[model samples]
Target chain A: MPQTKTQVLKIDKLSKDFGYRQVLKGVDMDLAAGELTLLLGKNGAGKSTLMKIISGLVLPSGGKISFKGQDTKKNPQNLRKSLGMISHQTMFYGDLTAEENLLFFSKLKKVSSPREKIEGALHRTGLRKFAQIPVKTFSSGMNKRLNIAKLMVMDPELLLLDEPYTGLDYDSIEFFNDYLAEFKKKGGTVLLITHQIDISFELCDKIAIMQNGVAASHMKTASYTYDDLIEEYQKR
Target chain B: MLNKILGIASIISIALVGYLVFFWAPIESSMGIVQKIMYIHVPSIWLTFLALFIAFLCSIGYLWKRAEIYDVVALCMVEIGVIFCGITLITGSIWAKPTWNTYWTWDARLTTTLILFLIFVGYLLLRKFMDYGEQQARFAAVVGIIGFLDVPLIHQSVTWWRTLHQPSTVFSTKKNVIDTPLLVMLLLSLLAFSFLLAFIASKRIELELKSRKFQKQIANLPQDHH
Candidate 1:
């Protein structure tokens, strides 16, 4: 009984170009509420560009992006307040402690009771023990964990993650999956970009495969086999 | 409420000092009636430099903390400094016509004032070149701090290298030449100028915030057509 057209995000005729190179051309897609959508592509695919456009970090050359029935182009700041993004680069201040970093962004987002939220985020991320240590002192996997904690503090309506499992160990990946499962259970929409097909199959309810600056295919998780996707990606 | 009250107080004090400068303070025997210009001129120059210094400090703070509000304050101070420096040049020219027998001179103070004017012009130009938001602020903050370093050197150049300009007498404790009435007028002008700087700076800060929001809107326009 899911409403297919109850779109949380709608992108139409999106195109982006850099000089002579076209990165995204006439890409169209839709995302629904409470659905975890996995974006699949090789290294040169325009997945990151599409996410940047959605997050208000980069302006598209041409297109319309609407979120929650409002035009993202008209209300980027308000959209940004509701959208949480975690990329490969941990966006926290290196000189500040984990708790301090969360506290600062929380205030920037104008979240009330920031200190209490910081403590809650730290506890959820299992970094409560290292909360006082500077982020620069943490290992790569630990830093990513803190990044997740930062996103959790905001409680965003839409979460965009670019390669969130890049440097994690097997145990950390399991921990991340558990957190994501809980996040989806709470009705938070997630758009994840990753090269790993197994993770996509295990986590996503819907999948979009991009190639040559456009979405090559969009299908339900059950419609395509893992080998079929790998073959389709290899052919392009 | 406080700023409004302060603005009114400054206006009243400036009026009283203007009366004192024209009537109560005695004209100097050497420089004649034109010497009275210093009662307003010197204090404006001093306050301008003081405002510039505050701007430099605020710029440093903005860069270090990456706060948008600090950049607003720095921009305000730079604008106020430019206004005062303009006044300094005009009043100095007026004073020079009767005292030095020329409307303009390449004296150290005059040269330094010109340089200070250019520095603020560059600061404003730098802001124009930037696309706005955090990068513009960081660039402006760095330039503001570096530009204000010249202010102290400019003030000292008259005394430091034996220039044709007279050294500071009001600030020097060893041989101050200002009389009591003239001193009171100068002090009152100083307070009045400071209040004016504060009032204008606050207004400019509001404008900067508005401009930032407008720029964001303009940048987002291309993406709405699809």
Candidate 2:
């Protein structure tokens, strides 16, 4: 059944090196349309590097990535148009308002008719009331929510979420969980990097554990137990 | 090995320039031995313009090619230009005290040259403080290109305005404006300074690359050892 789903992203033998240190050795993974895949790994397993490469922010030292069956190196416009990245880093103008931030990113993403979408995003993040104020004045948790709001208007096909729930309050995390469910229902593919494995087990359709800079195992969440995942994760 | 060769050659060329400037070139009727300052001052100005022009070109190349090499080269060139600009200002002020009767003046050419120096110094400071990744490189490229536009204006300030500084005689189209020996000595000084600039740039770029490698090593370090 997983194989029958339309494959949205394919990465084969991806490797990245920073000087003499090899961060990613040879990573191969697949994400299908409408599937929310949770990527689990211990710290410094090159999960963020893999996400950066997928989002076209960092070029890999070796290997290839295909988006919608097209080589990303040749057809980077496709990656730009379809990829939405959410990281802890909010690369927004501190002086700009929350609404202004979304509008700016929407324009960069070439989102048409972003007016209503911006409002919708602001409302979803529960920051509509604070949209008129500058982002520098907002709390850390508020900034994280605004990050989600920006991605909502991007209309991307594949979402790369890295530590999205790091600074969130309890209510915001619940809201994000529901938002992910809704996004999946709309046929959006997601590769989420998070350490909250128990909560993620209920949301992610499949779990991919990374070890030694490679995707060590992929298992169906429905068929695998918590103990099975821990056993496989500890194999590193 | 090549840098060592460049270093020795640069030292020899500079010694040759010092000999020609101090002993061979005829002294001006009015300025006397102080006229020798022109030999170093004029060439420093020329080398400053040359360095900034190269930085401008490399900045544009970085924007177009997205190559880290271009960024490194551009930053190095900017530093060289700033150093020469400082030399030009200091030597000009020293010359000014004896000839223009003051140590400093706000004339058109002097003001424009000072602005050029400030702009590139700002470029260096921006690189020093900011940069999460490639963002600083992009910002510096934009600043380098815009700041370099001040160079041509500084060159033409003498012609475009009534300035206290003397009009450029070395690059002038008129014949016999400067004595032939003086012009030759100035050209030789430029050649010597250029070799020195190139040598510094080569070493600076190599060190910068090593520093970036170290920074990447830190960035890729594990969040926790356990």
Residue-by-residue lDDT tens digits, candidate 2, B103-162: 887755676778888998999999989853456777999999988876676667644664
Worst 10 contiguous positions by lDDT, candidate 1 chain B? B166-175
Error of 1 at A223 (Å): 4.3
TM-score of each: 0.53, 0.75
Best TM-score among the predictions, by candidate number: 2
lDDT of 1 by residue, A1-53 (tens): 44454678888889875433567888888877777888887776789988988
Instruction: Return the DockQ of model 2.
Output: 0.07
lDDT of 2 by residue, A76-118 (tens): 9988888788887877889998888888888887788998999
Best by lDDT: 2
Pairs of colliding residues, candidate 1: none
